[model samples]
Target: MSRRAAGVILLAISAFLTGVKYITASIYSTSSPNSGYGADSFKQWLDYVEGNLTTYSMIVLIAGIIYLILAEIDDFDKK
Candidate 1:
């Protein structure tokens, strides 16, 4: 696949992952008030999500952007 296509795919995947992260967080957060058991559980969940999904989403987003930029530069150089 072309760099542009790869970049678009990566960006779409990153966006979907981010949306899932936020939606899951919101759903969990609203299910119970943040206190005692609920608060602790939420904290743990947040930590896990931030460590894994959030990290990967950011990396993918950045990589996608970088790929687009590089593709543009390559096109510019060609011209």
Candidate 2:
């Protein structure tokens, strides 16, 4: 409803998504053969997942944090 509420929702959603991504990546790593010999490694898969999914969520998280900060600043100015 409000900017603060929206920011809180976004923050929660981003946190949830990030947590889900880690769970998914862990499951994926276990199922796949991610040997660190060449290109396929658990770290690489995690990086890929982070780039594909978590990156956007991270951006949203940052945006939400900024929004919260701005809201606090605005409220402080009003008082």
Best by lDDT: 1
Candidate 1 per-residue C-alpha lDDT over 15-38 given as tens digits, one digit per residue, 9 for 90 to 100: 999888867765666665653356
Candidate 2 error regions (>4 Å): 33-41
Q: What overall lDDT, based on C-alpha atoms, would model 1 receive against the true structure?
A: 0.81
Off by over 4 Å in 1: 30-48
Give a tens-digit lDDT track for model 2, residues 1-79: 7679888998998989888887876777777764444335657667757775777798889989988988898889999
TM-score of candidate 2 to 2 decimals? 0.72
Model 2: worst 10 consecutive residues (lDDT sum): 33-42
For candidate 1, give the lDDT of residue 73.
93
lDDT of each: 0.81, 0.79
